[model samples]
Target chain A: MTDRSDHSRATWRQSLQGWLWVAPALLFLVIFVYGPALTNIRFSLFSFSAMSLDWDFVGLNNYLRLWSDPKFTTALTNNAVYAVISVTCQVGIALVLAAVLEARIFPDFSANLFRTALFLPSILPVVVVGLVWQLLLTPTTGLIDQILWETGLASWSRAWLGEPDTAIFAVIFVSQWQWTGYIMALFMVAIRAVPRDLYEAMEIDGASGVQQFWHITVPGVRETILIVTIITILGSLKVFDIVWVMTAGGPNHSSEVLGTMMYRAAFRDDMIGYSSTIATVIFFIALTIGLVQIKLQKDR
Target chain B: MATARSFPALAVLNRVILWAVFLTLAVICVYPMIWLFLNAFKTTNDMFAATWGLPKIWHWENFSTAWNYGISRYLLNSLVVTTATVVVELSLATMAAYALVVLNFRAKAAIYTLILGGAILPPEVSLIPLFRVMAETGLYNTYFALILPNVAFGLPFTTFLIRAYMTGIPGELREAALMDGAGEARIFREVYLPLCRPILASAGLISAMRVWNEFIFALTFVESESVKTVTIGVMSFAVALRADWGVLMAGLALSILPILATFLVMQRQFVGGLTSGAVK
Candidate 1:
């Protein structure tokens, strides 16, 4: 009885030590992450500027304004479009490439070189990517347009980033170009981890290559697909840098996302309450999606 | 026998088509960066006229002009911020992960979840409050303003990553250390820290890359020219010189070169580190 009591005492002391180590990080998260998240709600209720503390409590007026505001609606709509298009294209291309690479479709191809080239853009600074794409898509002297004209496809060479209809799509294509490799890398590792014996067993049972892929490979990486889709969705929801630097959500705000819209509201337009409301909306959207992802993973 | 004979020809055609697709994708991915590089060496006229060709003369002056336009200062500021963020993030995460993974605590699961909660909470949600907090505390434009949020935001993922790795370390080793009368700090310092170098490097590299390339926070927090990081600096530079493609390309190249060089040298670690945490 004494020994068990002593062990319990020791465990309590060890727990105290453990919490001590976690205290500093917890403090930081409280101050920066959790605190700010909660405070965002408080800030959303008040009308104020950047630094001024004096403000009026406006209740749900800011959020109500969001419904009436055309820019906010456009930003929300554009974000939805960006999310749908980017997730489909990026995840779709990555799935194909990962499966192909895992299957070793071209045995002679340099996997290392291909991976390096593809991933290069993922790591490049968003500013650089925006600048480079801006140059390439410039109508008069841009390399893309120049090449299109030279190849007798001049009609296809109108300003890619200038027009409203094509601007968001253009941004989404740039996004796919930057991120597909990253998603592909994740999927490649997941597919490779699928057991080799399963494939061999299926082959012996007279399953064709396509049949084997559909039966074994697709289901094998389904969880990774889900996780990657969640990541891609969250990424598009918070995507500001690409849209900000590419077009500044311009050509009549055709490409504005929630992130950029939030920035413009608070900093550029002095709508702190409205900005915080937008921030709150973003938080709930992310939280709901994140919860769904977690629940799905748990169910699996 | 006839089926076997025809299969080889079909496989050969399959290989041909696959190679063509792969090569085309590779070219599409690589051609723009190469064009950017080639354009950096050309004058404005050459950049316009000889879009596909190599530069007649490498205009090294573009780099000098970019450097003089405060690119060097922006690079230094970014380096300092990135280093500080990495150090703080790794150290705090290491301690926290060690506690969560190695220590026997009842609320450890809840604590872990709380920390990981930061990962999903988009920075957009926190930006205004953080901005207000910084302004109130008089840290709005300081390096700490940027470093504080960077470290805080980076901590959850880094802690998650390090804890995942530390869990794989044999508990017997930690048990032995405890038996020898080693304290928690000592066990962490002497036993876990050394074993943790690889994972630390992984977390550190990934977080460092993120901090180095981050734009939104830097843009929102720091307003002074002296404190501006590379991404925002390069953006302003690009905006300022919209028509001067030579200087703009050179500035963009300069901004990217350091990270690209580091990535090349540590490509294996970067790839492994980035994809390591994403996997279940």
Candidate 2:
């Protein structure tokens, strides 16, 4: 490699030129991701709102005051529920679906069609997903309740997205429906990557199908599972669009996650300082969990 | 005795039940659009009477109203910002990915960790600071506010994807290219970049959708009516018509049309993009 490099002025030039090419993106991140993150920490220390230019230096008060706010407490609980429940249902369903699809029971073409069909919902715009679900779940005229009534199961019907008890769960269900297939596809690919020989050998040894899955498939995709776990944790924590659109964390903030709470505080309430504080807490939660996860994985 | 004979029959019944369950979900997933498409044509009266059943008359004009009223210049705003973002994001991501994979920087490991860390930093945290910067730089309420931030947020994902694909590339290619006196730029152009077209295609598709559909930042950062992107445009329409069912649905459909169309047509790219390095 060095010998080739010595004679090749072009290679050296390309190496230098490549940095120049990518410099803009790096600069963009420096200003946007890194720079803004620092600014967020700075904002947490200062009293600032979008409405006024005069911000006082109030060190740690914002973070300290968050502990006293009932709204933050409720929001923290809601975010916890949202993250845990959504990720479990979504990833668990994904694993089952991936297992089912990997069996290759259907004709190849039909199987691909089914896979594609299942994957379609994930790519649809979140606004559309929320609206479509809202309409479908509308209590009075909604097709879901209407269908339940028509089918003689009126007792089973309820205002799925409108009721306080059910709205968060409804949103979570919608998220699960959309995201499960996507993660399933990931599991499918990971499953497919495991050498067929391993599975065949397990079968040859008279291991049950379930046994093969436990012994061969799960181990093969442990890293991918961790990846999905982190993705789901981070994504679920930041999930605002669906919650914001569907219920606006409503039926009276019953579904209010941190994201919605932050949005309302900053934009709706004009309390930018409070919102940045919430944003700080959120950042710490995401960052700490992510670091802990990476540490665990590394230790493993 | 009867139960013992039923095992084979039950096995067949179980498979059938599984298939039935699968198709049931498929129906649930696809049924929303059937209702949406029909409702798009229905009067609000029809919508209230029943969520299902056919419209008395097709109201294709809702599309026009949404376009003319809700989208209009907002559509142009979306196109401009998304195009600029995808173009810039991909070009930069590709170059950076090449460096991360091919070059051995002194802090290469740390750089990689930084990139991964950047991926988890939610964009909302930056909203106020970004707004302040945009205001200070005098780019607030302009397309630049949305475009520049979108690109930055998009970079980590695209870079993650391109790097995944780059790992599969053989070191010998670089060596051979170097032996032939081709510079790294020439090799990236002649060898790596073209080989990465499929991955790039997916990255571009994902970035476009994200930029187009992004709402929170666009809502906050872009305030001018002329500069508003479609998501916030539709959102504002919904807010104004909070009690008006027909107009809200109309706005929703209108906002979704571009993304829906792009996703439907280039769905393969979306799927490819999701799997690229997203699930790792």
Candidate 3:
């Protein structure tokens, strides 16, 4: 009985020691992340601004205001459009590119060269990307317009960023240009792990190269596809820097996303409480995507 | 594999088509960067006059001009913030992961779950409250404002990666260390940490990259020129030098080149770290 009591005491000592190591990280996370996240939800219900410390509680009204806010709806719609286009281009085309690379159609040196070039943009700061693209898409003197003129397609060149109809699409295209290669690299890693024997067997059975890709490569990298898709979707929903730098959600808010809309309302408009409402909605959307990820992983 | 070669003409056509596609895509990927570099050397007139040619006079002064225009300050600020953030994040995460993985503990699962849950809390959602928190705490316009939140948000992923790595370490090493009368802390610092060097490097690199490139936090929390990171600095520089394309391009190049150079040098580690963390 005495020995048993001593062992229990020792275990308790060890547990306390473990807690000591974890405490610092936990403290920071709770204070800066989880704690502030909860406070943000509370902030959404109140009427406040940068000028005042007081938060006057006006429950549900901020949310009610969001329903009638045209900018909010436009932001939501733009984010949805961003997600769809991102998934289609970043995931779909990237997977195909990765599959081709993995198919051994080219020398290893050449393939790596292409991959390194493609991924160069992904490592750049989004600010740089946005700024660079903004310059490139400038009306008359930009490289893009210059190329169009050189190719006798000068009629197609317009103020891409200035047009309400084209601004969001232009921003989305730049995102794809920077990101698709990174996604392809991820897919390449997964595709390389797929058993080579499967391809050899398909070849023995007289399957075409395209047939082998569909039957073998696609299903083999299923989990990666799902993960990359979720990442792309969440990234699209939370995108701000590129849009803010390129358009500032301008051309009459045509390029407005939830992130930019929230920024403008809080900082520019000083509608802190109303902006928190938008932030809360962003949080829920992320939460929903995360839950869907969990569910899909479980289903697998 | 033999099927394609069975039809010699078809095989040649396929190869040619694939090569064409690859070369075209590569050009699209690389041309913009080449154009940026080319334009950085030209005068404003030269830039517009010859959009696709080499500069008539190499304007090396553009970089110096950009450096004087707050790019230097931004670079210094970004370096300080990124270093502080990565150091704190890695230290805290490594300790937490060691405890959760190696120590005999109660509530380990619960603690792990709570920490990992922070990963999905989008920064956008917490911006307003975080801004207010920074302001009230007097951390606003200081490095702490940026470092604190970056470390907080980075903890989840760093800890997750470290924990996954630590779990793979042999238990016998810890047992042997214990047999030698080493304390838990000693075992962590001596036995496990040396073994975890590869993963530690990976986590550090990934965190450094994220913190260096972070924008919204820098934009929101920092109000003064002294504290602004490169991402924010470049934004203001872009506005201030909008008409000076040569110097603006130089500034943009300066902002990106360091990270790009580092990436090129450590390509394998960067790719391995990114893919390994995601795939598992």
| Fnat of each prediction, in sequence | 0.62, 0.41, 0.67
Kindly list the per-residue Cα lDDT of model 2 for residues A45-117, writing each as its tens digit. Answer: 7776786879988888888888887777767777778779766866677766776678665566766666777
lDDT per residue, candidate 1, A1-300, as tens digits?
012112343366777887899999999999999999999999888888876668999999888889898988888888888889877877787887877777755453487667777777888888889889989999989888988988999889887889988888889889888888888888878887899889878767767666776788889988888888888899989999999988888899988889988999998999898899999999999999889998998997
Q: What TM-score fits each model?
A: 0.95, 0.91, 0.96
| Runs with alpha carbons beyond 4 Å of true place in candidate 2 | A1-22, A155-159, A205-208, B1-7, B241-251, B261-269, B278-280
Candidate 2 reaches a DockQ of 0.40
lDDT of 1 by residue, B1-280 (tens): 0112337888677668767887788888878888887888888999888889999999999999988998999999999999999999999999998887767665776888899888888889899889878887999998999899999999998998898888788888878988999988898999999999998988988898899889988999998879999988998898788878898888888888887887789776777777776565
Worst window of 10 by summed lDDT in candidate 1 chain A? A1-10
TM-score of model number 1, chain B: 0.95
Q: Cα deviation in Å at residue A211, candidate 1?
A: 2.2
Best by lDDT: 3
Interface RMSD of each: 4.9, 5.4, 4.8
Strongest candidate by TM-score? 3
Candidate 3 scores an fnat of 0.67
Better of 1 and 2 by lDDT: 1
Docking class of 1: medium
lDDT of 3 by residue, A162-276 (tens): 9999999999999999999889898999988889999999998988888888899889999998988988999988999999999999999989999999999999999999999
DockQ values of all predictions: 0.54, 0.40, 0.57
Q: What would the DockQ be for model 3?
A: 0.57
For all candidates in order, the CA lDDT equals 0.85, 0.77, 0.89
Candidate 1: clashing residue pairs, number:
0
